[model samples]
Target chain A: MDAATPQLRVKRLRAVLQSVRPFSSPKIELEQYHTAADLAARILLLAQSHGDVAGRTVVDLGCGTAMLAIAARACGAGVVIGVDTDADALADAASNLRALEMEDGVDLVHSEVGSFCRSVAKRPRPAGVHTVITNPPFGTRTAGADVAFLEAAAALQPQVIYSLHKTSTRAFLLGRAEEMGYHAEAVAEMAFPLPKAYAFHRKSEGSVAVDLLRLTREPPAAATAAAAAAAGE
Target chain B: MRLVTQNLLTCQVKACMDTAATPDGGFLSYPLKVVPDAGGLKQVASPFDEGVAKSILPRLDWAALRKTAAELGVAALPEEVPAGAESDAGFLRSVYALVFDIHLEEGNLLCPHCGRAYPVRKGVPNMLLRDDEM
Candidate 1:
């Protein structure tokens, strides 16, 4: 396929992803909000441009119904792993994968982010994971949930991670990424639509400013030191 | 689950690597032997993308793939990735079959380390551990 072929495929896949239904969990504490398909496609395209994806192993943390996971596969990911704690969401994801004929490329694992990361870390892959794209809970319902996801994704040591978070917390998240030995930058910001799903929601439909972060692990101290020594620093 | 997926899995349960449990413990479980069910094996045609395969070659555990292929009675894969394997059309086709075409629809992935079994049903591997195992 030509260079533009994957881009066109991703466009079609994004439409299919938009058709997948969001989780209907009654508890807001679950933070089971679905990522808008257009936003996911944009993040994926950006990741592709940076050579963080395309034919690389991609992991989707807290993958609800496998929207990002499916998108990654459609864009030619070598392998896509979707980790989720909710069985119902995984079931839905499985159905969606079948519908899209993407069951072959994607694996939906029913597990929390932490355990999934640990399991993947134990795996013996020389190149390790290529990218992790996740839209974790915004931490509105549960405190520190987004951080937990970030911590887990960092633990996997992917080449890069593309994560979505509320724009207000961009500074704090970047600081945390720095502490974890990752160079993070907000690559894009957009209005994230939040449909009313709970009694506490004041508006039927509201949009919140959200940022897409691209995080890459910092060079090891030894490598940096060697480079500096070569330069006679 | 496809062999490509299995190629990336390792037994992560703590007890599975407990030195007290086995002699050669502490090492991650690899090449989890597949015990195929009566109708476990299936074949599906996948788009042959040489570029994707080339990109994945560096990341793949070549030794593990060789071992798994041996166990599965696939003799096409060589012990070592051939020189210029990336551009070799025949070798790339073989690699594609080993990675993408074959599927284990129903089976148990028996960890060589702790002898723990992870069941595969409807092509999904249940990697979740019990409470005590965690």
Candidate 2:
């Protein structure tokens, strides 16, 4: 049982994350879609491989049921904050933490993502949000909900943000990321399981194509330097 | 929430963000005071990772940490982050304790500016604002 291997680690992580309780009542309006444990392990492992998770301050925006938050903490994120608009989901997150015996492992905040960003922006210290990992609402129900989460993460000015979005919106989200000072790269594609939880969901079991996007904050100096180089050329 | 998280949280009330002046002339939303209930505080022993502590040290608001520590009855922190504090194990341990160790399981995070109280139950602070507050 050599956990040093990434494969073994992911297996263990997925097993632990599986213990997390899902939403008792999924909110369609909020797009309370759960990120499966296997997928969450893969994402967190990838982030850890890239020096993003371990000992980094990670914020989980719209952290429904805190699946990703728990994963991040388990993967050695120095500080993990799970912010969500829903109280019931946060209650579940708390129980998940206690169940995992990680009662103090993650911090849970109850706030809309937009306001949470605004409030954190006013901290006396410069922004300390190092990385943000979120499986935001795909905005299927509420128009622009996905982009709203992106905007909130960008406002924190973290070094990197990893978000899941419908693959169909790749071009549009890439454009938005550019406009928001991030260099967006679609890192991985996943078939996100859409377990039939809503009345509108027709299929008993279904999946959707999603892209895992890594939005790196382009350093202002580098951007300026590149622009200068382009101008000189 | 741990002080590490608290160090980053401010009052999210929309009116508070309008930059209303407090008596001391600080922005109303800058620091939300911690009001811990009796026997609400818990100190958990977490592994001290030097890398994490160093990365977070510079980003911390020392004044806010000091104020919160005083409220929680922790020992006084130095007025400033000592020179070369990153390599100072003792200093880092203290910082880790203040930031990551202390948890308010049940309490209220009262906003200094708007006098709004966000309740903390089961160690999760509810920062959700009402429509009127928003």
Candidate 3:
């Protein structure tokens, strides 16, 4: 028999795979798209490292199976929404949320990223919404896909935006964000393990570099002041 | 131990770099999003090595990264490989620094062949393809 993987999450994952009954047959088809332990730690890091997640409106772009959003809720985000284009994934996401007993803490959206971003940008965040988090795709190359996403994220100029991508992608990300008018900062990053017999990842994942970022928009003192004055009336 | 660093070290896909394009660069596919199994989460990727980054630096499509880098307001790197620094570990460190240290908080990885853009939100890259692209 193959030697057992020693990683804690790996061992834990193997157990889950063998035990968890499927909602209606396992959604194994979407297994390749779920978030693993390492990334979960990263999301936790983003929540804890930043002080508090309480009362923040989090829009999880490309939410895949809503794992991150659920984690965000557990970490104390006031509200969370999982957005994706896969209908089945959305259904699975809803089921997952129900399983976590966090269905009330989360919402699901079935839509494309760009259209979603566009719609959200057109309106102010409901009541207390504030942050947007995503793990966008970094196609075969490192920089191209991320550069475009960063540009779009900056357009809305949210106070904070967190994105995960390959290590081979920082220069373009930072440089592009600057050109687009937001100050980009690499806040916290951690490596996640990649197991074999999976899609997208082919190697025995050990420590491939993945980066996390915190992006802040430029100051709008003048606009803020005007808006405040108008509100005072 | 950035997840981004972990990926470039082990992504050994043959012909992985952007070939025939003016510049060549390796793909960094780690930092993936996975779902929680009853035991652990799925979709997470492996980490990379500092050593492989050095070996791969010279081969990176500098022209392409530079072009993309410039759009982000970074200084333009020379189109061709500069002399005297090919074998320098520091230079490779510079390459690793660029590839792994920066973050694309709100962006998408666009498909070079199809022009399809994948969204990157909250430090995660959504590299999913539409039914047609797949």
Clashes of each: 0, 0, 74
Off by over 4 Å in 1: A1-13, A24-27, A124-127, A218-233, B18-28
Docking class of 2: medium
- Docking outcome class, model 3: incorrect
Model 1's alpha-carbon lDDT is 0.77
Per-prediction TM-score = 0.86, 0.92, 0.49
Q: Cα RMSD to native, each candidate?
A: 6.4, 5.6, 22.2
The window of 10 residues in a row where model 3 chain A has the poorest summed lDDT is: A224-233
Per-residue CA lDDT of model 3 for B1-134, tens digit only, reads 12221121111112322221232332332112222223221122223334445444543445445645555443456676667665666665565555544544444444343344445443334434445432
Spell out the clash pairs found in candidate 1.
none
lDDT of each: 0.77, 0.85, 0.49
- List the candidate numbers ranked by lDDT, top first: 2, 1, 3
- Stronger candidate by TM-score (2 vs 3): 2
Ten-residue region with minimum lDDT total, candidate 2 chain B: B20-29
- Comparing candidate 1 with candidate 3, which one achieves the higher DockQ? 1
Candidates ranked, most accurate by DockQ first: 2, 1, 3
Segments in model 2 whose C-alpha atoms lie over 4 Å from true places: A1-3, A219-233, B20-26
Q: Candidates 2 and 3: which is better by DockQ?
A: 2
